[model samples]
Target: MRKWLVRRALAVNVRVKILGIALGVAVFLGGATIVFLRGYLVRVWTEDLRVRAVEIARDNASRSTDFLLTNNLYELYALLRGAVDGNPDVRYAFVLGPDGAVLADTFGPAFPADLLSVSTVRVADDAEIALLQSGHSRLHDVAIPIYDGRVGTLRLAVSEDRMRAQIGEVVAHITLMTGLAAGFGIAAAFLLTYALTQPIAGLLHATEAVGREEFAHRVDVQTTDEFGALGESFNTMIERLGVVERQRTELLKRILTVQEEERSRIAHELHDHTGQELTALLYRVSVVAEAPTLEAARGELIELEKAAARALKEVRLLAFEMRPAALRDLGLAAALQHEARAFTQLYGFAVRCHVAGLGEVALDGESETAVYRIVREALMNTAHHAQANNASVLVQARNHTLVAIVEDDGVGYDADAVLAGPPETRFGLLGMTERARLIGASITFESSPGAGTTVYVEIPIGAGAAEGADDADSSPDSG
Candidate 1:
C-alpha cells in the first residue's frame, strides 16, 4: 500500500495539474451554461406553445359563437374539426356544452371518453392554459368560454414536440461548444505548465547527475529570477564539492604512499640492525664451538653473550615501534612519557611531557590508545622535520573534552601548502587525522612558515566518561 501511494504521488506533476484544472473549469462552466440554457429555453418554448394554443382557441370560438347561439351544431362541429386538422401543432380541439359533455371533437365519433371527465376550470376573460401529459409527451391546453354569457368552453391542445426538438438542438450545440472549450483549455494549460516546470526539470536532472557523482553537471540559468539564482548557487556548490573531492582523493593517495614508506623503513631497520646482530651471534657460536681450550672458549662466550643482547635490544625496539606495551599496561600518560623520552634520546632534543586529568578522568581503552598514538606521531613529526631544540606534549581533559597538543618551537612548514601539496609530505598527517576520526575525535594543525607547529587533537568524553573516571580512581595511578 505504501509503495502504491508513493507511485501515485510520483505520478502527480505540474502538467497533470494544469490539464486537470483546465478541463475541470471548462466542464464546470459548460455544465452550468447547459443547465441554465436548457431551463430557459424550455420555459420560453412552453410559453410560446401555450400562447399559440390560446390564440387559436380564442379566434375559433369568436367565429363559432353565432353558430352556437343559433343551435348550428353542424357548423360548430365543422369549425372545431377545422382548428384541429388545419394546425399541425394542435393535437385536439373540443367544445363542451353546459352539461360538461363533449359537444364536438376532432377525434370524431371515436373521441376519447376521458375528455368528458376532465376537470373544468372557470375563467373570467383570458383563456386558461394548463399543461397536461398524455403518454410520453406533454401538451399545453388553452380553454376559453365562447362569450361572457356562454355556458360552454372551447379547448385546444398544442403538442410540445416542436419546442422540445428546438431545445434538443440547442443542447447539442452547447455540448459541441463545451468540447471545443475543453480542448482549447487543455492546450493552453499544456503550454503554460511546460513553461513553468522547465527550469525545475533542469534542476532535477542536475541533482540526479550530482547523485551519480557527476559534480561537473550544472543547470542553465535561463532567467534572472529565483530559479536562475538557484541554478547559479547549485553550480557553485557542485564546483566546490568537486574541489573537495579531488583534495580527498589526493589525500588518500598520499596516505597510502606514506604507509608504504613506513613499512619499508621498518623492514630496513629490522634487516640491517637485527640481522647483523644475529649474524655476529652465529659466528661467535661457531668460534666458541671450535675453541681449542677453556680460556679461548670463555672469550668467545663473552662476545656471544654481547651479540645476543644487542640482537634482543634491536628486536625489542622494533616491537615497541609497532605498538608500545606501555600504552596498554601502564596508561596513556605513561606511554606518552616513555615515547617522549625515546624521542628526546633519538633526536638529541629536550622533550617535556605534561599530563593532567588522565589520572582524574577515566577513558576507555580505545580512547587511551588513540590519544597515545596521536601524540606519538605528532612528536615524531616534530623530531624528524621540525629541527627544533625542544618540544612539548600535553594531554588533558578540559571543557568536557580530552585534548592533546604536541608543539615544537621550530621552523614550521605551511599547513595548507603541505595539505594541498603532494601526499608524500602529509601522509602521516592524514593518518593521524584518520585515526582521530576513527575514535570520534577531531585533529587540527596550527602552523605557518616560521611560527612553529602545534598539532591539537580533541576527543569528546561522552557516555564512557563517568565510567572511565571511576576506573581511574580505583587504579593505583590515580593519586
Candidate 2:
C-alpha cells in the first residue's frame, strides 16, 4: 500500500506537486502564527482585566471607609450599588466586615447568606487578586482590606465574558485572513511552477517524439535560462543522432555491396585460374594415357605433374587471399613481418618491419585478424598508389593499448578526399574501418598531398594487460 502511494505521488504532475507543497507549508505556518497570537492576546487582555478589577476594588474600599466606620449599612449599600452600576464588567460587588460577615451587598435582598462564607479567601497581604469560577461564569475576583485590616473589606467580581467575546472576534478575523492568504499563496505557487516546468515539459515531449524517430522535434521554449540551454543541447544531440543513423545505413549498404563484389572476384579467380590449370592437367594426363612409347609417356606425365602443381598453387593462393592462414598460425606480429617481406619482394619497395612488446602481448583471434588486415590494406594502398620507395610497419604496445603504425615516404593523397569519395573508390579503407570497429579499435590516417601517409590502428588491451606491461616497459624506445 505504501509503495502504491509512493508511485501515485511520483506520477503526479510536477506543477501540481510544487503548488501543493508550497500551499501546504504556507497554510501550516499561518495556522501556527494565528494560534500563538490568539493565546498571547488572550493572556494580555485577561491580565488587563485583572489589574483593572483590583484598581476599582481598591478605590471603592477607600470611598466606603466613612460609611463603614459610621456603621451606616444603607449608605454603604448605595455606594456599592453605584460602583456596580458604573462598571458593567463587575458581576457582583459587596463589603465584608472585619469578622468575615457580609455587610453591604449590590444584590441586596437576593444576596445569599453563604455568598461570602462559601468562597471566603484570606490573604496575608492587604489586597490580593485572583481568577475564580462563580456560579456559571468565570470571574476576576479582587479583595481590598479597608484601613489595612482594621475595618471591613471590599470585594469585586469582574466577568470575563466580554473579554472572551473580543478575543473570539479578533481570532475570527485572523483566521479569515490566514485562509485568504493561503489561497493566494497556492495560486502564486501554481503560476511559479508553470513557469519553471514549461521548458521541462517541452523537453519531455520532444524526447518522446525523438524516440519515435522524429529527429526534427525541438523544445519550443525560448527562455534564456539553463533549461533553454539544455533544450538547445538536446536538439543538437538529436540532429547528430539522425546524421549518425543515416551514415550507419549507408555504411551497411556499402558493406553488403562490397561483400557481393568480393564473392564475385573469388568466383572469377577460381574459375579462370584454378579451373584452367586443372583442365590443362587433365589434357596432359590423357596425352600420357595415349602415348605409344615409354619416353613420351614419361614426358607427358612430367608436364602433367607441373600442371597439377600449378593448379594446387593457384587454389592455395586463392584460399590465402580470402583469409590469410599466416595470421592464424604465426600470430599477428610474425604474420605482419612475413607480409612486409613479401610486399617488399613483390613491389621492389624498401618495407621495414619493427615489432616491440608483441612477444608478450596476448591478443584475441579477432583483434589480431583486424590489426593484420588493417596493416595489409594500408600497405597495399601504398604500393599501388603512393609511388614512393620507403615504407615501414611498426607494431608495439603502450599503456594497455596495442598500437600499430604503418608509414610510407611516398606521395600521399588527401585523406579527407578518400574518406568523402564514393564507396567504390575507398572500398579497401572502408573495409579496414569496419574491421577495426568490429574489434572495438580506432584507425586514424594522417596524410597530405606532399607529406608521407601514416595509418595508426589502436586496439584496447582490456584483460591480460599486465603480461605486456613489463615487456612494453623494458622495450627500447621507438622512433
Candidate 3:
C-alpha cells in the first residue's frame, strides 16, 4: 500500500502543475518587487516631501509681510525654521519683494527676482509659490503670499534640502524590505508547493501502473491530509481490481467451456439427427424415381431430386455455421480462408485475404471457435450491408495481438448510428462486439455514407496457443 501511494504521488500531472505554479510564483514576486522598488515606494517619499514643503511656506507667509511691510525678521525666521529643532527640511525661509529683494529670510541667500515673479504668485495674487533649483543645490521649494487690502507684494520661501534627505532614507528602507520579502516568499512558495503535490503524484502513478496490468504496484504516502485519503482510496481500487480480475478470469473459463460444450452437442445433432434424416429421405426419393410405375411422372421425379439436393446443401450449411470441422482440421488460418472464399463466391463480391505473421501453430478449441465466429460475423455483415463489390481480409500477429480486419468498398452506413440503434437494427454488429468482449479483446468499425466500411478485431495470443489472423479486406458490391 505504501509503495502504491508513492507511485501515484509521482504522476506526471502533478509534476507539470508543480512546475507551472513554481514559475507563476516566481513571476508574481519578481513583478511585485519591481513595482515596490521602482514606482510605489519612491512615489510615497516624493509626496511626503511636497507636503512638508507646503506647511513651512504657509507658516512663514503670514508673519513676515502682512498689511504693510512689517519686517519682523526674528518672528519670520523662527516660523520658517520651526525654532531650529533638529528638522533640517525647514532650512531657509524668507520673503521677496516684487523686484526680488529679500525681505526676511531664515537663511542668507537673495531670492532670485525672475524666480519670484514667475513662480506660483503674480503681482497682486496671493498664492503658493513653487520652484526647483537647477545648478549648485537641489531644492523643490514652495512659497506663499501675505497681504492685506492695502498691501500688494509679500512673499515667503522655504528651502527643501531636508525633504530630499528624508525621501532618500525612506527609499533605501523600502528597497531593502521588498527585496528581503520577495526572496523569502519565493523560496518558501516553491518548497511548500512541491511538498503539497507529492501524495497526489504518487496516487496517479499507481493508477497508471495498474492500467498497464502491473497489479502488484502499490502507493505509500503517509499523512492525514486529503492526499492521504486519496492514497487509501487508490489502495482500495487496486484491491478491487485484483478481485475483479480473478473473478473475470474464472468467469471467462466457465463461459468458454460452456459455449464449447454447447457447440459440440449441436454439431453432433446436425451430423447424426438432421444429416441422417435428410440422407434417408434422399435415398427413398431416388429409389422411387427408378421404379417403372412412375414413367409418366418423370418431371416430378426431377423436381424431387432438386428438392433433395437443396435440403442436403442446407444441412451442410448448418453444420458449417455450428462449428466448422476445418477449424480443428487445417487450423485457424486455413478455416478462415475457406470461409472467406466461400462467402465471396456465393455473394458475388470479390474477397481478398491477407495473412502474415501467423506462424505455424496450434490452438485450443475455445480460442479457435471464438476467433472463427468473430470473423464469420464480420464477413456476414460485409456481404449483406456493405453493398460492396470489392472486399479484403487481413490476418496478422503483432504486438502479441491477433488482428483481423475486414473491409468493403460499399456505400458504407453511419457506424455510430447503426451501432447506437435498437437490437432489431444493431443485432449483428452487437453480436460481433459481444464476441470480442467475451475475450480480452476489442473491436472497432469505421464507415461513412460514401466511404467504404472496415471492421477490426484484435485479441492477445499467448506463446503456446494457435492464433488466427487476417487483414483489411474489401468486398465491394457497389450496386
Write model 2 residue lDDT over 268-308, tens digit each, in one string.
88889888988898899889889999999999998998999
Deviation from native of the Cα of residue 9 in model 1, angstroms: 7.9
Lowest summed-lDDT stretch of 10 residues in model 3? 470-479
The TM-scores of all predictions, comma-separated, are: 0.72, 0.80, 0.40
Query: What's the candidate order when arranged by decreasing lDDT?
Result: 2, 1, 3
Which candidate achieves the best lDDT against the true structure? 2
- Cα lDDT listed for each candidate: 0.80, 0.82, 0.66
Off by over 4 Å in 2: 1-17, 69-88, 96-124, 128-130, 133-137, 147-151, 176-192, 195-214, 279-297, 341-350, 383-389, 410-434, 462-479
Q: What is the alpha-carbon lDDT of model 2 when measured against the actual structure?
A: 0.82
Candidate scoring better on lDDT of 2 and 3: 2
lDDT of 3 by residue, 145-216 (tens): 555423333333334455456656766676567566656665676677767777767777897999897777
